[model samples]
Target: MSSPVKVYVYDLSKGLAGQVSLQLTGKQIDGVWHTSVVAFGKEIFYGPGICETEPGRSHHGSPLRIVDMGETHMDEQTFVEYLSQIKEHYTADKYHLLDFNCNSFTNDCLGFLTGGSLPPYIKDLPSDFLSTPFGAALRPTIDAMFRGRASTGVLTPPPDISATADSSNPASASSLLQAVAAGATSNNSEMPSSSRNYLPTPAPTSPPTPVQSNSLTTPVHIATNPSSFHNVLHTHRAVVAFFTSATCGPCRMIEPVFEDLAKSKSRANDVAFVKIDLGVGMSNAVGGEYGVRVTPTFILFLDGNKTHEMKGINAPELRTQVDLLLYQAFPPHRHTTLSLPAIEAIPLNAILSSQVPNLDIVLAKVTGFIDAAPSWSGSTTKEATKQILAKNIIPYLKARGSSSPPNTSFEPWKDATISLVTNLSAGELFPVADMWRVALLEPAVCSWSATKFGPGSPILVLLSKAEGAPRNYSLTFLRMISNAFANKIVARELLLSSRSSITALMVAALFHDDATVRLAAANLAFNMTMHLQRLRVEKVRGNVEGDDVGENEEWDIEMTSALLEVIEREKANEEIVHRLTASLALSIRLSPSIEQLASLLEVLQAQKILKDKLERGGCGDTGVVKKEARKLIEEVAEKLCS
Candidate 1:
């Protein structure tokens, strides 16, 4: 007989997916809404319908599954209906394990059941599936209670089956016997479908042969044979748990992707990765205790217990949740513009709005992308970025556009724009490459100058808000840049952007010019006197038309050293300075090896020169003009000394 279909299922906590379930939000119905198909070894499969979930009975990591017959043409719509019936008739006690994507499998069953005549697409399901019109036949209805569609409490918490069989009914035992028989018989052709018949003891004459209770007793933890349950991380450490089902079609497709994601996120030392499977049957009762009802759920455990849960998520969401969870748990030991959300948001745009210009430009591009991007891949979180853009940014822009209080222009730049086109001039917007001749040289165009260094203690103030507001999309792009740099991909991409050293640097200069970076860099330079690489003071004496250009500019070693000393010593906060300085040191150490070494050599030489100047004029009767200078020098000297 064909093996009894085993599936993993979880009882969702209302706090996570349950809350999402309540919101009933997502683009699932416009076709491929929360659903998309993936190939199983080249054959398409979709799965783990929500109705198939067994509430209260299922654990946190249940493996509700798909009966993996190779690709079938069953429409996701028909598939949705068929599983609802399966969930009702077979219910919890009938199978070895419940499939999370059971409905999809059921639709697939009809493909086989009706001699492979299932409709190829949901739109072809005929009008009847929508609501029972004259030609509208009733399609399979899901447990609509969660969706607020209608109360199809067909598979709700059966108080008896949940917590000991409701004892009020004396015939409950006999009834359960009959149900079990039907469930077992229905599962296999070889076994008499009704083999386990309702055989009640002879009128309660003697103690009955202890019949196992009809109620599904959820074990504390049940794991598949290859699966294991682990606390993995103690309260003192970070924890990441991978939730999965063995038979699920979508889960199978995403497993490799997940493995890649987890590998990138996990560190064997501080962060822990534990894999949970509901398919392990009675082996992993511990997972059952947590109510894992879905396939491929990722639970972010902080300080030993689940602080956040990511269910029906894909590699990207998994990556995001891990990042945010890790950051919150461990408090990253570095200053960064790349916060958790930004990390997810940035790469998200990089992948989605890839052709768009700057982050601000992409804000408009966000709407166009959402309108055309297609919906979520069936039962996976991969397309979550598209979904999120639709939910958050797209709607926001739509509202702004409709209000039309201003901004009527269609041009990319329609306003009286004053951009600090300077940073883009030297194309320092590109990379750290040096000494490459380029005809791309336009006169230096400086856009921004600090607002007189700010009255509130040396804060940077971008002068022209003329183009609109200063973009704060930094959070999104920050993570992307962080990942790009972390992977050395930015450098590699710069090289590949063009074999021309200039082009790569041009790209780097613009891309890294985001304000978050400057602030992050400034913060890194905070409170600490670390070596500044590339510290040459160019001498320029010229008219606006470039006369007197013969002036020879020399690198003023001691004065530059003094400026460097002031920059480090003037850190507003001691602790911040200490941290930023240490981070600054680390960043330089991580810079491209050869060029940075030369920069370091120059800094060291400059430091020596400055030290000599201080030592040579020690406590001399320097003029009143030099007294203030003496004080500054002594302060810098004391800092260097200590």
Candidate 2:
């Protein structure tokens, strides 16, 4: 059964904003809006992160109005699972009043549940308010008001609200609702301060200007007052504050030690090192607020709360505390605990093929084809395309290949390429595809194509058209797709949005009779493996935006099967074997669930096949490529399979 989803809209200013906004900002704002999604008998909102209460019984009291959104077909269990997946993104430290707030969280939940959004007035208020002069002037004050407070992190959900209740048991849900409503009403008088209304009054005097640093490696000097100190603490997950005075001898003794620690230990945006000089003007206020009575004191704050404090020039103790804070903030991956040197040593940089073919010969072949075709007489598209090649695309590729800045815009070339791919047949498209193979090497072209066309991009379309065509068409198409990996955006789009199509194309190309076509296919595989491995490395290093482990496990499995099949039949080219082996190693190494991949390899009898190939010294003139392939295969066999 579908449940109704409603939006509970509360006026944070409690009718005061509507009365004073016009006079204050010269704009007639309706209200300072805070919205929550009401569904599954709970009022869900984001404040100190994803709080829930009975409908009409939150700390905000009664909402001004309730807007009924459409019903959601998603079951309660499924919705709760979705919430668990997204709860981290809505943490207290990440919330910004104007950027990410209650309304934003409501809109996201509404879209997930009912495929709907909050009302336009509530959604557009921040942008509208910012457009006014007074609103723009108040931005720093607003930022200080919200971000200068200590973060409470993610809140624990109320015990009465059981997210794991059975969907079929209507009585359980009814009991939960009643319990929540009673508990909320009984505690109404004792409720804590609402997140929206917890602002502290700003100081009357203006703050001191901060001494800015050029890079994250340098520690930020505290300026202004206690508010600046709080702002830095609230912004980063882990912070190390150095409290010092200019004339203190011990402060000078440990200054370089602190600088070295900042350079080595600080992570961009995640961890921060701050300096507060008590002898400096206005900065003394921060020292008083933190209650530092002595010089050369080090304090460590995690999630806006003091965790550790140290005094004097004890470098060992300071390092230990800082390392502990990092460990708590970002725990090392389980893979790091394992003994796998080969997997750990894999290079993180992408192996992009940027070699541009001779543009003069490429342009001549394309323009000559256009001139010879009987369909090209007096055609504007043909003339325009020729001009684009000679005047635009050719020169751009030549300049980019030579490492000089290209003066022309990439937009015209993109348009012409799309037109040709749409109009020409597979037989007549090889020359155009060859030209694009060179152009795709340029990052600008790949970014433009990805942004302009997205999933139905010109490169993907061209590859689809050239699928079963002649050897030349296939080779160029493979090279074009491989070169598209030059831009991460395009590569991500192709990997995620067009996974099936790209996978099928790769599998077919691997089985081609032509060695050159198979070689191009191997190159594409190597690039794809490099991209995926880079994501794995980032995730292992605790990058929040890295690709989740096992996200592409299915794709990797499919590609691995095809590669094993091709490798077993390969003869005459050691480069192909080496590239294929490298790709296979990367796919299985450091996999979140290596046992699954090892099982697949064992079922396929891969170990015996690889051993036989190793004994044969591979298929080439020299044993060099074979040696590299053997090393990769053995690494996989021992570390992955064992």
Pick by lDDT: which candidate is best?
2
After TM-score superposition, the amount by which residue 141's alpha carbon in candidate 2 deviates from its true location, in angstroms, is: 13
TM-score of each candidate? 0.24, 0.55
| C-alpha lDDT values of all predictions | 0.29, 0.64
What is the number of residue pairs that collide in model 2?
A: 0
In model 2, what lDDT does residue 65 have?
Answer: 93
**Pairs clashing in candidate 2?**
none
- Any runs in candidate 2 off by more than 4 Å, and if so which? 1-5, 8-100, 104-346, 374-380, 401-406, 548-550, 617-626
> For model 1, how does the per-residue alpha-carbon lDDT over 1-642 read when each residue is reduced to its tens digit?
121222222221212322221112110111111111222111121211222222112212222222233443545554344434333322222221111222233333333322221122321221112211211111111111112211231232212221232222224323432333222211112222222111111111112111111111111112222212342343126766666665777777766666554434433234555555554323245456666777776667777677887667466777777678867864532222222231112111111111222334443343343334344233213244334433443343334424342322211111101111111121211211100001001001000011111221101111111112223322222222222222111222222231233222212222344544433333322211121121100101101111101111122222233334433333222222222223323223212232433354365553443334434232222211233333433333333222
Candidate 1 — which residues are off by over 4 angstroms?
A: 1-405, 409-642
What is the C-alpha lDDT profile of model 2 across 1-642, one tens digit per residue?
A: 999999998765455555444334334565656678889998887655567777887766788899999898989987777666555555555555454566656766776676566675764454445544454554555455444432432222222212332122234333432332232211212344332211122111212111000000123333323544665676689999999876899999997888667745655456777776676434577788778999999999999999988999998888888889999997765446757655555565555555667788878877776776666422248889889889887777777756666677766766676666666667777878877777777655664566544434667668678667887787878888888765565676677667778778877888888888888888888888777777677666644334322266677678778888888877677778778877777776656656567788889877765555565455544432545456766766565545
